[model samples]
Target: MIDIVTVDTPHPYPPRISAFTRPFWEALAEGRLLTTRSVATRALTFPPKPISPADWTTEVEWVELSGSGVLYSHTTIHAAPTAFVGDLPYRVAIIDLDEGIRLATRHIGEIAPVIGAPVDLVAVRHTDAVSFAARSRA
Candidate 1:
């Protein structure tokens, strides 16, 4: 497990979001979020895309999620990659949002999280980039 720390600096690299991903980013910027839903399989797909990987269908729709969920899994890392080195000992977690979509994000807040712990998504601004944090249970 990596000992995770909150990153005070902005992301060093530019996030690459394509045309299909524009809506998702836009929603985040607007405080309204969107994720892709596969019509055929009735599944929520994160890392939004125009087509579904399972059925190859271009029927993906942008759906808003509650942004509240539980921490499905996580790890605290002491050392990070070059770009993320400044934020050593940071917690990386997979949050299972209320809508049933699992999103990987940096864990934040006061307490260490455990599996099945309730968490809420919060948008945080770093020097130049915006990121999501999983808040510990209230």
Candidate 2:
């Protein structure tokens, strides 16, 4: 298990964009979630890659997900990094998307989430980038 720690000072860090990850970031900016799908096995990969994991196939495609998921696991952070300090006592959770992929995301809502509870995607905008949050579904 990895220990989550609070940083000494919050730094304004942005995600580094590479050739393979550009599309994913662009999609996020457009309020969409993008992933890479293997052409051969139809396997989907987050943190998009250039080659397929199954057969090393270079022919992969960009796919969009519905962004609906369930709360799989979580932790409440009393101490956070600079960027997130204002949102202390926030919940970081592992969400199991309906499409079968799991992602570590933040719960940005008022209520605490329950394990196995329904969640939905909420777009989160930073200074120069956009990410996502998992919130309880209404």
For each candidate in turn, the TM-score is 0.83, 0.82
Q: What range of 10 consecutive residues in model 2 has the weakest lDDT sum?
A: 1-10
Model 2 C-alpha lDDT per residue in residues 28-138, reported as the tens digit of each score: 767788889898799987657899887899999999888888999999999888867776777889999888888898786767789999988766666556666787865
TM-score: model 2 vs. ground truth = 0.82
Evaluated at residue 99, the lDDT of candidate 1 is 80
User: Which whole-number lDDT from 0 to 100 does residue 63 have in model 1?
Assistant: 76
lDDT of model 2 at position 65:
87
